[model samples]
Target: CRIQRGPYRCHEKTAGFNFNYTDDPNYGPFLVSVNGVAGNNTELTFWELLVQTGGNGTIIRPDVGIGCYIPEPNDRIILKFTEFVSGSHSVSGNSSNPGNLTAGNTSRLDSIELVVVNNISNTTNKTYSTDIAFRGVLIGAMRRLQTNSGFNFTYTDDPNYGPFLVSVNGVAGNNTEKTFWELLVQTGGNGTTIRPDVGIGCYIPKQNDRIILNFTKFTTNSASGSCTNPGVLLFLVGLFFCFLI
Candidate 1:
């Protein structure tokens, strides 16, 4: 079922590759010539015929005797064959169109010898093989409803979020803001804030700060439930408190 290893080089004058068929009682030995060959009296099974022709020798069908080496476009190649199976012996097109080599198996020919003329083009550059590596970047954020009725959030400062700058509720803040370094010192609050570690950190909008909710400047954090009705209500209330400043 496989072709023999190595390429079968053939010249234009070379006739079809010859094969011997063995006699079998069940199907009876038959003389079968592929491409254009004179019929002979030989009895052999279909499997045996293929095995003798180096069919199982290689990965490709070596019985075809090398496919026409098409070097260029617009080239003509012909394939013929003869099957000797008593009166029932026959031949048919293997592909879509007859006489068209590019059209796959045409002439209903079981096998054919290949001959390459000057139809295909030659390559000057030597082909080599190599492996390639690829890298990608991804950024993400999460918003969740705090068990205490507030919102909890986390985000990275990676470029995947676009430039390093981040504006929360309209106030500019860097990654250090999430660390709550100043808040911890001033308010004696624990350093429990989820600090932005990648690029810039999150900022809680202060009183008098301008803010927008659209994704353009601020995106809803699903982990913080920022887009939820309760989250939105909290944000609005915080904004109202800011205006009092």
Candidate 2:
């Protein structure tokens, strides 16, 4: 792939890898290639971009990446290659304040980042961070991450609880058989675990929050908790009445 970054340009090609191509239905194709070298053919140091601007030189992150953005004749596509102090957004590092693009213009990257990990899989531990809109429910974030970050998540909408998370990357959390999707949150660097008080559709995420959706077993004792079962309770109550008679 040929990439143009400002005055520098290069052609990058890789086999058996799909990281460079991000295809969207509406926006066409955009390139997020990481292999572009300088015109001198040195190793390309940053992610590729096709930035659309308002001619004030303020560049907004493209609605999508290269494979998804079909260019218009009048559109300004700035090719910028930059590095991140923290390469964790999966594709983004420390972002230079999108404010550097200038004021009064809404062309800025306004997204949040969340890290996802699954304890159920035995595969090599690979790390990926999901970057999505600054404001949205957890399901919305999951959809965005599924597309951009190359992770898989599935859910079902229940009339009672709204959106119930079914699984992550093919690992299902069964609620009836005593298995569940446990929600764990870690804010800042705190080592303690905080269980969320809300469901996926109701909970909103804060920046820098590590969200762990774990598939785990229910810990209720069958003897004590079985009393909550209507069938068992009914049978026990009938026996109590017989004793009184």
Candidate 3:
């Protein structure tokens, strides 16, 4: 959202060339969008390949998506927006709003157990099996819990970390103060407790994951993990530039 990726509309000097596209309300930017007239059954284009023409004029489409594609010097980027049409391939454009990300048929993962521990002693202050949502991230679960239930918590977006869990039950943490909240997961039906190998955005809960938002403090280099993966982090990261809501 801070124009760290590309086409930063903000007042920032050009570090390199970047492209601009609309942040449509219906579908995301990676899903192609059209402004003017379109056919009735037009669909959102799925960005196929991110062609990087090197100095030697060689093309490459990375195994990952455009959101996670890293750029190097002397690289030419070509974005191919394409879609399938009646057993044929065609250019991508705005056909209609993006399809339902999570269809209505999914009703299995309804709730999850959330254990809130304050400080190092790990005293369980609040515990409940809140409803699990299709938010696609841990932050979304917090937001949904706040609305569906009465769970109270606050967080800030770190340029490095996706969602900096600052305070829970009225406690806040900051970088300079060497204090921050950490996330821990209890696996195997809540028997074993271990820190997640990855950040919250990348880790999707597998039904019975006991999400523990622990309040802790860190020293000069302790709070090191901040998220950069754009696939799931885009929705929250873009808020720093301009939140849709």
TM-scores of the candidates in the order shown = 0.13, 0.41, 0.55
lDDT tens digits by residue: candidate 2, 1-245: 33221111223544743334332221222234444432111332345355555455565554223322333334565655554333322322111122111222322223444444445454444345664344334555667678866678776643222345666667675535544455566764554556654445444556666666655554533212111122222344432110000
| Model 2 residue 242 distance off true place after TM-score fit, in angstroms | 36
Which whole-number lDDT from 0 to 100 does residue 106 have in model 1?
24
Each candidate: what lDDT? 0.21, 0.41, 0.46
lDDT of 1 by residue, 54-79 (tens): 22333221112121111112222233
Q: Write the per-residue lDDT of candidate 3 for residues 1-245, one digit (tens) a residue.
A: 23343221223444653444433221223323323322232453344444455567777654322322334555665555455353242222222222322333234344567877775655667886765554244555666677766577775544333334556767665434445566677874756877664444334455677887766654323222332222222333433221111
Report how far off residue 10 is in candidate 1 (Å): 5.1
With a 3 Å backbone cut-off (N, CA, C), the pairs that clash in candidate 3 are 42-95, 43-95, 160-226, 161-226, 161-227
Worst lDDT run of 10 residues, candidate 1, spans 132-141
Question: What TM-score would you give candidate 1 relative to the actual structure?
Answer: 0.13
Q: Root-mean-square deviation of each candidate, in angstroms?
A: 32.8, 19.3, 8.3
- Report RMSD for candidate 1: 32.8
Alpha carbon deviation, residue 119, candidate 1 (Å): 30
